[model samples]
Target: MSAALKIEEEREWKQEQKQERISPVTFTTDRTSSGATVYNVNRDYITHINVNLSPGCASPEAMDQMFKHIHATYSTPSLSVTRLPRTCEPPSDQITTTYLAVDPLYNSAILSIAEVRAMIGILQIMMVNPMLCSSQYLPETLADLKRTMTLMELAIRAYRHTDLVHSLSRAISIGVEQCRGLLEELTLNLASYRHSLASGALNLTRKYVWARAGQGSTMDALDYKLRKSHSSFAACLLALGYAAWPELKRGQLGKDTLDELAKFYVELEQESTSLRHIKVDTVIVQDHLGRDLPVPMIFCTSSQDFHVVIAGFCSGLAGDVLIQRGNYRILNAGDQVIDPKDFGTLFEPGMAVTMSILFYEKVEERQGIEGYSCPRCQHVNSRCTGWVTCAKCNGSFKISPEESIVSPETEQHADTDFIPNERSLFRKISISKYAPTSRRAAAAAASPAIANMAPSEPLKTENALSDGGVGDVALDVDDIELDEANMVEMNANTADVGFGEETYGMPFYIREKGTTNYLTSNGCRRAEGTQIIVHPRKNDFEKSAQVFYIDSYGALYHAASGLAVDIVDDVPCLRQLRPVSGRPNPWSHPLPEFSFINSQIRVKFLSDPAFPSCTDDLYPNGSWATKTFLLASNNEKDFHVHPISDFSRWIPTSDMEDSLSYDPKKRSEKTLRVLVERRTKDVGGARTSWEIVPK
Candidate 1:
């Protein structure tokens, strides 16, 4: 062979030897070394990262999802079989090559500090060029940013606790540098913009200003929002820096590096403190970025300890706003140390500042209740009574003829003995107390012999109540038996109170608070979608007007029908616990449970855990999405029961004529729908409250 040919062959041989040396390393956990459970690491962590999510997002679930994605993606092996030539045909139907196995137990972990850096990059992009994101996803992106900062502070704490401070100091320093760069870039950009306008390189037009007025606000407002966003971001970075102080000071670093870190943190503290004196345009920030995510939030951190307050608020304080130098506690707007329990319970997590603002600003009106005044002394009393003894004047007088101050409506129905608006709930009252006050009176009036009988005389009835109400005199409010064992023992399966029919569960009257009205089903109908309404108690006991019960899951179910109470189109209606099963759509199914809030005074529907797009864990509101809405109905279908997830089908089908109608007679009204108010009030008043009144 020629010298050139020989050289080419030698080069090819060397390339093959290099390929053999660089082949993938494989291992198995087997002690015998048979290699039956061999595994290979593909190093495809990037494929595990979700591209759809903004790189800055770092919630615990997001981190866990990233890990799961990596685990699932890495376990699948690629096919690289080499086919043999037909000429080598001793038994030639097959092809052969090397096969590598993947480990099913393999999982990957990511550095939390890397996630923090990604968050900084995204925030920089948002501050510099927010237009790159669509308008709808802006809120989600801001939420991601807030979550990222929270995780960063938590990771720093973990590093200090786990003795990883020395190893993580380099990454923490890099993150701090990135944050400093971001602050500098934001400051320079704003300065350059102002300088260009001052130098006459850029000019504002009247039309431009007017157009922006309709859009939101002026250019100055935009500048304010940008500045606020920058300050808040800086405050967060400063907090993280303080949290990682132990890690930062772990190694023997050069004087220049230490000085640089100290200078950056000091500058951040100044910016954060200076902006605190200025009134931040919180409304604009909320509108642009979203509430609790990136408003004028304050983060408290300490250097001596791993103390970091996530979204703690500070108002009207002097000096070093970012660092909690001494107290190491989160202060609320009231300048009081916040309780730890308030984090995810009272207000949303990382939303103490926003909630405080709304509580002080938006809640302006107070609910008033009118009280009865004494005719002689003019002393106001909470409840009306026939006699009143004034505490201030020490005078006594008769206020009304009826010794007990009952409403006129209640007096008219007194002979029927209806218990209206029994407010003290969650307590057991005996069956004798729950019995109609007029039942004994009516029985006495029916027979003169019974009226003439002595007070101690033992009267007889076949199916008397279980609470020893066999023969009892008319009961006064004070004479009623309370402090009983339980409602189930006192009233369950009893016949004396006139529950001849079987009840599904513990029967109770859902009465409007401070009123003589009760939540009644229209007529005694057994229809699936019977309209639930508030109406005056009737003399005759009807199953429709009598009973409602709460199930184990907090769903209020009408005893007459097995259906549960749910709000559809803002109207309370009866719906099946579960809609028709096996439906292709899950939203077409009604949510299984409803919940009570504020001591069972307020009721709100709960989302299904299995519902599509429903988050697995609770968010800041203690729920996925729950907000208050007015209770009103414009059309009959508004009261129609539908699936909880079927919110799209709740549009009213009423005509314009019906919607615009003002005449009460012309409107197709059967029963009055329950009016849900923002505040609760007393009974016998126009604005009444609700109570769980037992039968």
Candidate 2:
């Protein structure tokens, strides 16, 4: 190196003080990235910064100065902390909720180089336009996410020696106060925002919740992704914060929190897989190829009232999916209480069966980003995982951050569970020849009902006993019970309401009461009057969805796959539903109560028309889609809080599970005054009544 060149380098590295004061403070919603809102910058015209930002010779001081100046400059928008309306009108006022992204592995707090780079990338995007934060919302949130990610990484790096780990554990405890505080703030902010906005006005809807009314744009999705990334980081911090070295050594965390973490991953994988199989690629996530990506799966929830189970799916973050137990809440900042009363938690993430929360990268989809084999290396990843081997070294590599992009087939999802398919609502059923065949089905199937519904071919008999998946049996149509009381002719009064089970991926048959015929899958294809008859076949490409999971929160999820049972409206028909991974947590509602009904308990849908049994009477939305184990409710109110509400019930309809095989002959100490909802031949709507039942 020559002396002149050395001097030039030294001069380049010299940090210079500011030459002049930067512009005064202003605000702007328009940001350079066009993803999120920026704060205190001149939106009227572009502002240029003159500084070299290359490494070593790069001037960070100059960069900082430019950033400071940008912060100083401002363009005003209507941002006020006070007088934000709590109540809203229709459409705009349609109750909505905001959810956090899913992080099953809880890797946000870990200090891996790859994760750090990803965290930095996310922060850079947020800080890029620092003048557009939602006044108090995004600003504090971005700061917290950025700070915790960096500090944890630094803390771990400082503890390279095993002995050093002990010395530094206490230091982490002291420094993490800010991270903990910020996490609390973010949680409360998210909960309150959802609760307020769901019942609040519509246009303001976008301000707090993303993907509202299905109008969520590209930017809204980006913002949603950013939050999920931050959440992983937060959960990581919360788990590690204040821990002693002993706590670290044991690898033990509070079971409750750990269970929640388990939930996060389980939910993620389930939702993603379900979406892909169903071909409802509505959720969007980052391509896992980049080292600078956060937990890529968004959070998905059960599509039922007061659903507590949260799940998501991902290809990155060391797993394909994650799940956790979560509920939303409304907490005021600085008030500092997390109890449900003070903060008002709502665990009901309304309608995971309706729409999806994961938004896809529209631009990348157009570029044909996925589906090619590595012909040179003979590698096929099914997804564009950015797998590459150096021609010379055979070393592995990731798609460079400079080229970081997204792949949608990881079930390219946007927002929500679609709506009430008549099958989903489980409406009136008649003979296939007698069923309605005239109407048009919706443009898309919300549930997997269309693709995975019963086979489109004519009803054939399938024997129940076979080694193959939903294997080889021919069902005898004569077996269908013909008792007049159970099989009344079609008429308004004593009307024959048929809600034949339309199990796609065919499930075990359990006959409905008074019907000799077993409840079975009826192929859905905008076709009506389909017979609920079984088809004989050994399962091949089809995945069997058996072993239904009914969680404590009254959510009925497919155990093998985390897909929730849901319905769609407009052109009512059956649709299998799943939430996309990596979107914010769905807004939640209060969890419902449970009761024991001779082992098998049932959940009810509390609505204007409550679910009543075979009383020779029925209504459209009443008992439709309410599964054998699950119930439906139109009442969006506090079904969880009020055990006395007539809209809710826990009946034991052949509910004999292993756990429910209690001492029914004896009245135990845990006896509960169960509020059962029932309708009769004389009643107008179902009413709630007390039934003494064992817990």
Candidate 3:
């Protein structure tokens, strides 16, 4: 090669190196011969540097050191760096700078990279020193911390836009490390008051008796401080996420570090912010998909009243349905104290129920925003001016209430118990039969005269016993003695006087004097002359039992019939009273209204020769839908009545299987096959015993 050619190549290489040394901060994309994009550096133009530092951090010594470092790093004549003095006096005490052209949309706030680094450095100095982290310095420190984070976010955002995030890598790394340090310091601070930060009753105790006069106020202050600290800590974490985006994006942060940050974010969102609330431990609730929810209910107990905060089917965080049902109580564990009225009677020791304090996210009205947020559906209505109906849920709400987004009553009734059939309270049963005919019949079958008093079906015989002569069956003399307590008082002398107010007693099964039978309402048929019958007593006979209330004449009136029980032709029947005046005076003296009184034919049931009879034929043989049980008598009569064991009396079989197994899902599926056996003597059980063995 010629010496002249070698010299030309060498000069070109030297010129390229000199150009790279004083490269422009900004660059333009150019296409190379190979068709690959290349960023060209224009070194002829000098890049100006602006350094804006906080007033408290920018001492003369600090400025000189910073200047020396900048001058040493960028020694090329093409670079011009300047440090603005505090005397320049920006608009406010707040230190700000603007980065131009990096973000074509808007100039980045905290203009220079130098200002961001300075703010981060100041935060680090204050964080490291224990004395500087005192209570008096917290507020100022938090404000600065948030401000620095915002500036960092803007810088990172600008760099990202210009595809120059790598240029701020070092700054990003330092800022993240400082964030972690601040988080650690804040965590320790919160830990110092962990007990107070936890949710519970903040009552004055003997330990704080010395400061009793100021205890309430002290507790209030502490609560506020703790909440504020938490808020600041959360804000710091949020800022860290923004500042550490470059590292997070490139996977520079370790899995553990990333996981820790993610966990913190999740906890921040899940943690309840309410002052005093208890978490439900065992949720007997299941969602629509049949998943168990740990904290399915939110209840608030104020004064003596308790109501649900959130319940029923709701949209979950991920859009899956969260179906919660039933009432829940917070069970106080160990030394914990909960108000008796709010919870209930003291839960027995080792009661599987457990509880923890809960917090709630209080819904507040949004301000300075162009939308009205629905408290119910959380749908935003940006176009609404005053009262508006939510497009999503069709729920109506005022633009914003005079005081709150939701009224107190509206909140309480938002998600309550599901009422079946009843649509509007104003609609009466007589006018509309919205309830299904099957439900009415099922309900009537479950509890005879309680719902739908006017029976739609005829009386059916319960047992295949003869309606023969009562004289055929022998009666025991001792058992024939009637208890005076069971008899209703009938004072003919005071019949004219009124019993100021009506009185009713607990519903009872009226057992006849000589038989193991009760006075049963044949059916809820409102025919005037239907005679009440005597049926063999079964377990839980409240469905067939009677409720008696005292009338104005002190006479016992059957609540279902609104008539007094009287002996008409030697039969117990509901009888309408004869009116006193010829015109049936409306208001001479207020009397009970008698709508109809037809002398309908009566029903009679004679004692069966076989005292206790079988009801096997009575079972709906073809209907598998109806729950069936067999209650066999020990005497071989083989009575197969529906067995509903009153767990209070039955004993477990010698095989040692638990007969008291309860499963909420399969409630109708019986685990025990009970046999009603009569014993002459107490061999190992009661005379009228139920031998219940696992089915």
Best-matching candidate per TM-score: 1
Rank by TM-score (best first): 1, 2, 3
lDDT of 2 by residue, 9-119 (tens): 777545221211234343322223211122222223222222212122225476456545544543222354111122223323322221111121111223232343454
- TM-score of every candidate: 0.28, 0.20, 0.16
Q: Candidate 2 regions off by >4 Å?
A: 1-126, 129-137, 146-507, 513-517, 523-695
Give me the overall lDDT of model 3: 0.32
- Which lDDT values do the candidates have, in the order given? 0.37, 0.27, 0.32
Clash list (residue pairs), candidate 3 = 97-111, 98-111
Show how many residue pairs clash in every candidate, following the order shown: 6, 113, 2
Clashing pairs in 1: 513-689, 513-690, 514-682, 514-683, 515-683, 590-644
lDDT winner between 2 and 3, please give it. Answer: 3
TM-score of 2: 0.20
How would you encode candidate 1's per-residue C-alpha lDDT over 1-695 as one tens digit per residue? 69999999999778656544543444432333222233332321111111222122356466557555545654343455222222224534322222211111000002333444465465545545432222344344344444444444444433332233322332333333334444445445444443433333233422353344332233344334434454444444544443335334634544544555556455445544543543422111111011332332222111112122222222112211222322123334443435432322323324443111100000011114265443334457666443345554443333222122222443443333222222111011111112233433333333434445565664443334558565534432222212122223334324212112233246777655556767776664544445667677766666455577765334567777766665543345565443212121232332323322221234433332223343332233323223332232222332223333243332123222222321111113634655332223211233333455557
| Among all candidates shown, the one with the greatest lDDT | 1
The C-alpha RMSD in Å for every predicted model, in order, reads 21.2, 28.7, 37.8
For candidate 1, report its TM-score: 0.28
